[model samples]
Target: MGIRSVLSKPFAAFVVREQREWEQKAPDYQHKTLKNLVSKASNTVFGNDHGFKDIRTYDDFKKQVPVRDYEALKPYVEKMLTGQNDVLWPGKPAYFAKTSGTTSGTKYIPITKESIPNHINSARNAILNYVHETGNAKFLDGKLIFLSGSPVLDQKAGVNTGRLSGIVNHHVPGYLRTNQLPSYATNCMEDWEAKVDKIVEETIDQDMTLISGIPPWVQMYFDRIVEKRQMPVKDVFKNFSLFIYGGVNFEPYRQKLFDTIGKKVDSVETYPASEGFIAFQDKQDDPGLLLLANSGIFFEFIPADEYFNETPTRLSLDQVELNTNYALIINSNAGLWGYSIGDTVKFISKDPYKLLVTGRIKHFISAFGEHVIGEEVENAMKKTLESFPEADIVEFTVAPNVTPEKGLPRHEWYIEFSKMPADITAFKSSLDSSLQKLNSYYFDLISGNILEQLHIIPVKKNAFIDYMRSIGKLGGQNKLPRLSNDRKMAEELLKYKE
Candidate 1:
């Protein structure tokens, strides 16, 4: 038997137990889970005010707690962050994750003792599920490199505070830590450039079998390794076969990552936010992730179209329909109650539920009444890129040119290309054409002569990296926004155009 089999038996059993409970519990699992959570927290301030103890049904809970975004919940979070206990959860938070924010400067998200297992275990199960599906457990016997953030944390108001990955890294179980690469000293370096250099120095000669990270950052590591070894990734790490990734839609970086690996390998996707562990791609053949209903969190949905409305309708799991875009609201053991995380998703299956993350509720371009979403915009770019095999894109964002450009208002695309395309104008036209076909509202605006064709702005290399660095958002779950309704992002990008 392999070392993995001898060591990971308990984890293997845990995955089986979770899967069995998910299947056997059937349709009642979600309601059962939510009711239990309410009963547990009924004595807390949030729960007591919302009448949690008296609530026995979804309708009652719905009537009591109002949906809230980050700004609205800031007051309670602040109290909790100031060393106060039981502000949201049963007791004090074990740690807090710092999320990058615009208006608020920085958001310190709570990470309670009760919620760490959900994040860490679900991550393990994602990899285990892939192993189970393919019956390939040998991959675990070799070194697995996860390009995770720092593990060392600092105190904020007497509570440990850091990035989500760093917080999670500190809790990695002892057994699993054996095959994981990079020493603790190297992992905690604050400067990204210095941290990456150390990581390359440590792992360049290891017997690596799996790699994982957000695609763009992973690509940076791959590029450096290739430059150092004077060979492709296939030559450097012959044992590597699986890549696990998250944090952005993978389509834009798919070809680039594939080209860098220089060979085919299995991949698995996961949806993990600081708020909760939501879903994971559970099967090899299925694209959508299996939403975790029994993972210590209660789920609710609101129609995306009505989320910004004065009286939006909230739906239970039973009320959700396939193909409808709905904003996700979460309540978890981590002390979040009826929180709108701003992510929107579409249901793909009813029984043993599955879904696709559609877009963010606040991030989109609708300046011309075209109502374009992130998925539509990203897919259009993907299709257009497919036609130009020789070209590759590193990063891009779309924004509205509300000011008249010569004679008309249009969408402006800012792109940074690693390898330039032969015909730039043709590439831009193809992206615009695909979008028009995908979105009827956008097509009608063009057909009615209300808007001009999209504008493509080719940016200099490292534009995104430089922009993020200037704002101190260069790495660690911090991503540049894709679609904005106004010229905020589009116009600001011109600063670095020089």
Candidate 2:
């Protein structure tokens, strides 16, 4: 018997056991999670102010902790940044996951000792669940390459601060360290081009069976290897059978990614943010990820339409309905108190409460009355691409061309393609039609002659890559923005093509 045959039994038991247990206790899991989180964080400053000692139920907890966005809780975070104790959690946070903010520079999210285990466990469980479902553990005997942030981290307010991927690397168990590629020395190189070159040089010959990374950056790695070896990925990594990805919608990049593989491979999507690891694709056939209902996060949903209202309606798991879009609110062990993480999701199933991350609340193109979200834009692009099987989109972004000087107000698409369609005008019309069908406001605006036809600007190849590299967001957890309300990014990208 192989090493996988020996290790698979126990791994399957741990993963499947938790999944089934949560499924069995789905309805009451929220209550249990809330009680544990509230009881644990009751002595902190927030707890004292909110009277957490008397808070016994979800209703009481809700009343005590009014749903807040990051701006509302900035005071507490500011104090914590100055090395204050027990500002949000029991002690100072162990690490801060600094992500790009919606309007400004950076937002520091706490990652505490209690919170790290939950993140690590969820990630571990995701892979284990896959192994249990497929009965394919031979990959375990080979290398697992995680294209991630730099190993070198920066210190902020005496606490370690870095991207989530970098922070995660520090905690990888000692046993797995032997099979991991691109050593710590290589990871320390801050320049993305240098790191990718080193990673390809190091991993091209290794028995890499599994890989994990965001799609675009991973695509860069595949291109490099193929260019170097003058062969497909299947030829170079014979045992490669699994690829895991997250941090952006994978629909547009799916075809390009699979083209590099040269053979079929299984993939799973995860909904992990600096706030917490929210969901994972547990089963092979299911499209929606099963929410981590039993995790420390207490989930709440506000109907997307009412999200910007003075006082929006909040719904619990029982209160949420299938097929409804919501702004996700999370209160977790990381001490985020009823914090709206600014992401939107839709429930596809209500039994065990399965969901799909739909879009970011800030990441929308609402030039007119139509609020075109990330999911809408992505789905529209997917539909348009179906008509042209010969073409594949490498990267694309949509923004408003509002200047009267440019003729009329309309959404402008900046797209980079691996294979350009023969009929460019038809491609643009089809994309605009698909979008109009998805959003009524967009359709009405066009029909009423209030807006001009959507414009498609075919950008030079590698424009997105050059832009990301220029901005120092070419690797790790960073992603290119897909939809913007303004023309800043679109204008900057036009300069590249010109």
Candidate 3:
């Protein structure tokens, strides 16, 4: 083993031990964190406006600060952009994480000096946790690559600004700098397809062992590698053992990714956002992600079913129950107060607070009160795939077909398939049946004849990819939504329908 590898084992052990200590005291740590955040930011503009000085308990904090989405918080953000200090948190923000917004054009989430460590260290600890558990520090000795946005950043109000991935690229620790791959120049390429080609050229001949990115992008890299090398990715990178991914659920792409790899490898699932790194898979065998409770964010949960209600009940970490879907709310050290990042999660285990990212709050189909979520669709597809071994998908999205030219209202499934199933009718039937079983509201709607059995629209190969490119969101942290309530996406997708 090299010097770094020899040192990593002990370092990993220390980090894991520290994490375990905090994990056990999560509730207490969370309470202290909230108190500290409120105390520190009380004199800042946001804290003053929200009555943070008077907050003595969770109830006080909740009463003072109502949950806010980006739109609600935009006024303060606008002020920040005007070079205002102590607007959100005390002093100027260290960086602004630029991300695409749906209603609002582009969102610039602040990354404060105090909060950057939470982002950097959580990612590091995830790998360290893996090393500590599996005794696999050998990957550190080989080249590693993160398929990310151009590290080259722009300035907004004299503060460095760019995509979260790009901003994070600047903070990659010194130890891993020598092992990180694709070169700085290659990563700065704005064209994602061209960047992937350059990345393949750079890493194809190297000793790459650890690869990280969103699943679809990583799959594209693998496909390109296979095409160029005329061999599976596993054969090309023999020591490649760890596949780290975040931003989207991996279940839908898992079968196709492994098939392309020609072998299974250890994988780590992470829940990262421009707002913060929320959770990551701690155990290889475990199903859910370990929530970073003690990390600089204090979490609250609003019941997903009641999220649209006038007065939704918000629960603290200790108050959350297992298997119930809740919209995640956060009050972070980064100066975000009661911010909803739009993600919905379900706690599978409460003792250590491990949860599954069930879906998004806005990304659901409730056209006819069916209220089907991302998790239901993903799970249904995953289960349906088990019976159709020959069928594999590239990308897919669900939308409600309220007014079809010739049929009753239905949920439209626009799918891009790598390999079509032998029995198209059977595959559609299985997918529909699986969805109905998973969502009782949808089942009831189907039985009542309010909505017809879901219709599958097989899209032409590379249709989704082409669509993403058209929108200028082909790669990096961008993700294709699995579900949409309206037909905007579905209508555009019909142009590519097979």
User: Global lDDT of each model?
Assistant: 0.84, 0.87, 0.93
Give the worst 10-residue stretch by lDDT in candidate 2: 1-10
- lDDT assessment of candidate 1: 0.84
Q: Is candidate 2 or candidate 3 better by TM-score?
A: 3
Model 2 residue 250 CA deviation in Å = 0.7
List RMSD in Å for every model shown: 1.8, 1.6, 0.8
Which predicted model would earn the best TM-score?
A: 3
lDDT of 2 by residue, 425-467 (tens): 8998999899999999999999988888898888887899899
lDDT winner: 3
Per-residue lDDT of candidate 1, residues 1-498 (tens digit): 587855565667578677867855544778887888898788877888788988989889888889998888898888887777777888888889887777677888888888888899899889888766677777788888878778888887788998898898887767668988878888888788677788888889997888888887888888888989998888899989889988888888899888888987899999988888899998878889788887888899999989989879988777799989999999888888889988989989876688998888989888877889998999999999889988999889999887764867888889888887899889988998999999999999888878888988888888988888887777667777888887767777887562
Of candidate 3, the 10-residue stretch with the lowest lDDT total is: 1-10
Model 3 scores what on Cα lDDT? Answer: 0.93
Q: For candidate 3, give the lDDT of residue 415.
A: 97
Instruction: Give the per-residue Cα lDDT of candidate 3 at 283.
Output: 94
Using TM-score as the measure, name the better of candidate 1 and candidate 2: 2
